[model samples]
Target chain A: MKKRYLAGAAIAAAAALALAGCAGTAGGGSSSSTKTLTLAEAQKATSADDFGGMDGLVAAANAEGHLNVITLPPSWANYGQIIQGFEKKYPKIKINSANPDGSSADEVAAAKAQKGQSTAPDVFDIGTAVMNQNLDLFAPYKVQSWNDIPADYKDADGLWYYDYTGLMSVGYDTKKFPNGVKKIDDLLGSDFKNSVAIKGDPTQANEAASAVYMAALQSGGSADDIQPGIDFFQKLKQSGNFLSTLPTQATVASGETPVVIQWSFNNVAWGPAAGSAGNPNWKTVVLPGAGLGSYYNQTINADAPNPAAARLWEEYIYTPAVQNLYLAAGAYPAQLAAMEKAKTVDAATLSKVGAAPKDFVQLTADQATKAASLLSAKWAAAVG
Target chain B: MTALASNHGAGATPRRRGARPPRRPGTGWIGLIPFSVYAILFLGIPAVLAIASGFFTSAGAFTISNFSAFGDPVILKDLVGSLGLSAASAILGAVIGALVCYAMLGMNPDGWLRTIVDSASSVLAQFGGVMLAFAFIATVGNQGLIIVIAKQLFGDSALSSPIYTVPGLTLVYLYFEIPLMVLTFMPALEALKPAWGEAVATLGGSRWTYWRQVGFPILAPAFFGCMILLFANAFSSFATAAALISQGGIWPLDIQRALTSETVVGHENEAGVIALGMIVVMVVLMSAYGVLQRRAARWGS
Candidate 1:
């Protein structure tokens, strides 16, 4: 039901762009006349074909000499290695990654605030709901591998596309709970008293919000409804089982939060980090039920200071090599199915992380918007 | 007297009608230009923009609707929480700081005790935000030193404290607030002349009478003024509270929510609205502080 709304909205947006005739080109206000013309052309180009070829795009991006990316932490989904690779590949273009710990909302805000400046973000790696609301801020540009990405995961007009995804999972201290819970209901027992924590504030953090949605699905609610999740948390709080502190590697190691609900990738990353922090008994497991998956989308800023560099970045990350980096980091890349079919994916990493969940549930853009509004209205009153 | 008379005579010499007086030596205020520009650029412009944003909608259209956030029950509750917390910390800090200042009166001016305490007060007053919060957390948090010690000494049913609660937050705020109070209030204490006490004694007044008639009366305005400054200090603090607590239970956290809420769309202006509230309170208290400082300065020189 929610998928239909997303498809309809994407179609409508594409049609509106078509009716406008020309591609939207928000100007880069930081350079000289010649550079401005180059940036303008880069902003208007929808694909490498428009610039003649990938070689032409690379030259144009080298001329720009800089790329601004935001909300991309080095440790997230093996972005540290991916960034180093991009820098090694394009030595001329300096990648300025700003506010690496900022949120998806903060990325949009920075793009809007720094639109015309040299410090403006050239690309955004943001969550779906924030991407949906700020669609106008993006310039439609397709990568060479646009065909490989699933149609449902990318905007019809190439304004935004999914980059990487992860499933929701339960991470726990093995010493405290040697026999991990087989079900969500096990957390409600006395043994888990005042020990259960979420990743962060549900109304702000994507991981925490996904935890709620995962609980809602397990409690018999659909993607369009998130009230049951709030109710579940409220029940957890009333039973003195819910710990208000956000669960982090430090908290997990210190036994402050014995159990946490967060993204599977984060939990997987924490296993080694927590071990070094003295708690070698950390364990993560995908719950035995319907899996909830969420993905962060990538988009080019319409007013990118280095438009050519932005386009090059989008092209670079979507390649098979970069996508494999995400896979190795316990995340399922956007082009996983295509890579698997073509045998381009790294098989060893695939076997280690297990096959991607084919039937994992996701919130459509419209469903995400609805769920966000619902959480904003009821989360505090319910859980507080 | 001769210099004044000669200056008057020179000024009285028939000058051109509407001509300006001669510039006085050492009265050149041009040196203040850099500071003025710095204040206007960094402090003035951002403040104006933040306040002006509250009057506009997300679409950039002028509207008064954003101020409606003030009427929100949650906002009001948080405002009350902020007020109570600030008042508690500031009042306690001021009283304790004043006593410490009073105790310093008996010490020799050049002695090690006064020198060490004054220097320590200056440094400790600036120690706040995440570092200060971490200090308290390591000392008294869930797995902190004191708690671990208590558990070891008295077993499981022993001294578990509310180090994560509102009370705990007040205690953390006072860690810096008291030191700041000492730094600000000590100058007024040092301004007291010994001759005033000697005059009171010569007139057959006791030490209590001298303090009641002379010391308390003069320090009253400065005392209350420092307390107000301390209130404003705690009221506008965000980082210390943010580091200690995840949820919004006070005014600054409400601003943080408005600025960073991922679920709620187009409410960033409410941060400005909350900020405007803080500005109004600060402006009122600072005006009173200005007047009180003027009164306090009379005895200093």
Candidate 2:
């Protein structure tokens, strides 16, 4: 009996050791395929380097046959339709979208964590503030339509470029607020008590951060200063109108969050969805005084697993067809001006977006970075 | 094992007649090889790296600024909040859970009701994080069923604070904490033999006196051990709170902020420092638990 027990213990221990050894060996394998075609060099490629045209680049991407995208919510900016169009265009290359509900910070963290792994994100759709913070993690690659993109929109080295932009707006349930919130100050009324909410933590989420910046703009702060925005939230909290919880469609329909400060595109898209989900009175309005617009950027991960496919994705997103999809979803596509000039934009889609406030102020990279830092340092104290 | 023990027993009888030789050192250590290897790979390496990073700069130079950053008032507030939340939840869970266990003791242990409650407690204790937070929100949130019903009945706002606040969070935590308490404290309750009660009854001692003298004394260490476990569990928990509260002004949230907050540049080391602080707290609590558990083991045996 003693010998049998000893043998059983030994076998279990040996099996565990064997499993550990197997796991170790498994991870160290699978990174040794030598490619005659390297995607890292594609960043510096001209027409000649890619066999003289866009056709050659397409062939290369098709050969690779895979793309890993992170943080592309299907509802946000009509990524669902854009992704479908891309897949339909590139039948050979498969797209693996990860964490559709994850925030911008989660995307950057995944890029950092999975740096050299085969599972690393090939493409990223994140806030410009996040893109600037993690610039070293991006590989410089300009699409074929790079010339049409505004100079202010794209990085000089082509590490990152604007995809679509949205204005910050206030959304409210029509039934709850019979007298609608037409301005930022209207949100401070006792009727809106404990009803105002943003998407998520401003320090981590771009939409919420932009909302704060818009509030700052409305409350005497310029593009460079965000203190007024924090103070605005503080006063809102003091007035018992601020709710720290993230406002989701469910929360909106449930009447828990009747007022939300979010991006115009999100508000526009979510309003109808919330209406369909039993809250028919959902309405959105862009605040005239707080006309601040922010754009999300597109970039290729520095160590993307499917580099060719990533570059192809970047090329595809900036095209007229995809840009129109963005516009139809209520976001102002980055290539809107170029498409308008070329008359390649779908007029019907342009009409659907209607008109947004034109007096919007754009933040420089430095100003955004400063504002993010100040908000991160002060937001908790202000709201708490 | 019996054959080896017999052989050893035979050898020891003769050895006992004279002087026993010192045992070989490696012989005793061989049994621990598997556990030691597992710990070194998983716990030991990560813990060492986390501690080392807390003392280093992003460029890998030695620095104490990471530790000093804890002096920030926000960070201090988070620490206090985390401690207060954990303590409140743990104490509440322990008292309520202990009462539940005592109630179970009066029921027939083999009955279907006891069996169902026992199984439910086991399952519920582990049911927390995102799903649990959402569950509470659906039940007691601003537009929750209970709130809606109460509003109709009273013709006014029934609950003053929303479910996302600290008080609301404590209420949500109690949902899991009470069940966890029942599961942990039930075994200690079961260890209380009927003979102890019978002996007190024969001695003409009242029920209250019997419990005061025998029941409470025997269960005290186990109760304390469970409370510490609950405290540590609540202190380290992040997902439930993260899902509920968007702006984290608590320790676990601060730790998450240290890791994921983009505004604070080079916060990875600061995260390591915060993580190290959490580890220190957990270690201290666990050590106390370990001592209490050992003390309780005597009564259990």
Candidate 3:
């Protein structure tokens, strides 16, 4: 009975503690309450990825010097370089960007944690797909060059814009395919069995996945319809050209893999000649016909902590001066006017970039949802 | 009660024979000082903020929209996935840990072998997040060592496709979590002293009977506590999942929506709803588990 009493008394005490917990502190300090307007976004506001020239937005916030850019952990390595550039170019604007390990989830949490002026990420970079989910959180700030962005790339609401684009092009074994394996439909054979590699299942990324979708579109079937992609992979798999890894371009160049399907820049990054020196024969080609093109975009938060700098950032990135950096970095430009005067890509390179990707099909939310569903089903059916 | 009495006599009663020591008034609650501060800073305050933020708007007005986000399919799916994964990991940890402890208690090898096995628990217990995911990938992804070996040895076409599969994730969770369970259970299992089981057996008790009568009574509470720790540990797995979730497209939902989502749009509030749902489910399961454990403890005693 005494033991029972002790146990019961303990239970009561715990309950009281629970009730106390539920009641919580009637008042906590500003630490619980400050609204740090988070900008969990990339730099569309910077006018360009290169931060070309937007002195108006960067010049000391017009003497107020109030822009704290948190390029915190996981912000890509390039972002660090860009942030340094942003700071140097606009030192008067108090642009503070912390490092963050760039992941979609981290980007989202940074936004969520900063619910208001105190804790909000004023703006941040995110992928084209997730930009819309964050649409409500973002306030609209259209740039002067918004009209110049391809009609296909910019959202109707001006929530996000494609900063630059890449495509799922092939980097072939130039030694093996001396005849120049040129077209999209060329790799459909038994000869290249168990020979190709993908970074992930095509469906994992828009660039690679969009290639499959483009294949379907080229063969017959729009974005909402993706049977051709499924069939294409099915044929590739049957031929044994389906590899998950290491029959990659690196593998191919090393004679492990003969053909690799990868991004345009990736092919450039893997250039045997580009690496240090003395490495041989790393070359790439955009497919002859309209290739599978996808864009990695820059989005500015609507409720950016440094709204003026954000707008200035938008202006700076789209200019011809800064866009050359992207060209050097290996991506196509959004500005046609800039492209017209671009001394960046020479005649030989211009022909390879494939005539400025004639058909630009951006995915609408409903369209994307349906496309994801359809493509996903096709991917599973073919791969499984 | 009799054993405790003997223990009291064996130990210093501290009250009789002038053995009593005066309380240092300041140190009476000294042990709880760190706990008090830690609780407020990490747990108490964050929880209050999480709850309060759920009800209040940007302008500080109360609204049902926060709650409404809970009904969303994507949020619901994430909540279900989180709970399912956590529960599965916990169960796997428990079962695997229990078996490991059983092996340790009465197995083939002894001495250094046992020590090696014992140390393994601690080694694996320390791994989490990206390191853990990468380790699993190295072991199991399409480009993993095992897959490479399987292909080389068994003609390259094996089960080399778990890079982003659900089973692949569970396999990773099991790797670290089972080791953690063994670490947690080692002491509790060790406390089930061999002498007690022998004594119970001498009283004509069967193996099951001995376990039911004496062995279980001591370990029950500790087992439940360990399981609870495992549950909570696996509950908020954001980094590891994010690193490995290739095209599965499921991501960990957290805090609030100062961030934007790409896959599912126009649903920032859904994160709060998911968080709240997780809290509810966790609370319910923990409460049920607690009550069941209490009943088990009562019966064991």
Number of the top-ranking candidate, with DockQ as the measure: 2
Question: Model 3: per-residue lDDT, tens digit, A1-384?
Answer: 123334534643554454345333312211322222223432324332222233333432333344444433211213434556656776654454432433343455556554444223545655566665556656555676677777767777677777766665677767656766666567766556545555544444444566566667656656667677668877776765665443333344444445667666566555553454212565677665545656766666555545556666656666654554444435566764446654543445455444566665555557677776665445644753
If the candidates were sorted by their lDDT against the true structure, best first, what order would they fall in? 1, 2, 3
Identify the candidate with maximal lDDT: 1
- Return the clash pairs for model 1, or none: none
Q: For residues B1-301, could you state the per-residue lDDT of candidate 3 as single tens digits?
A: 1121112212211112335577666866989898688767866675666656666654467776877655545445545666677778888888888788878877544688788987887788757766886676667665567777887887735334454544456777887778777776665566556777788778888999988877777677656656665666677565576556533323252332222323333334444555566567556656655564454434232
Least accurate 10 contiguous residues by lDDT in model 2 chain B: B6-15
For each candidate in the order shown, give its overall lDDT on alpha carbons. 0.78, 0.76, 0.56
Candidate 1 TM-score, C-alpha based: 0.85
- Candidates 1 onward: DockQ, in order: 0.20, 0.30, 0.10
* Tens-digit lDDT string for candidate 2 (A1-384): 122334534643554454344443332211223223554565444322352356656666666666778768777878888899999999977677776777677788778766765567889988766667678888888788998889988888888888888888888889878999877888888788778999877876677888888899988898998898899899898998888777876787778888889977777777774347635777878776648898788888878866777878888998898998888877998888888889998898778676544568878878877887787678878987
Instruction: Kindly report which residue stretches of model 2 are placed more than 4 angstroms away from their true locations once superposed.
Output: A1-36, A43-51, A273-279, B1-49, B157-161
lDDT by residue (A6-69, candidate 1, tens digit) is 4534643554344243223223233221233365777888998776678777777776677778
lDDT for residue B211 in candidate 3, whole number 0-100: 80
- Candidate 3: regions farther than 4 A off: A1-162, A168-219, A224-263, A270-316, A341-354, A364-384, B1-37, B44-92, B106-120, B157-163, B193-195, B204-232, B249-260, B292-301
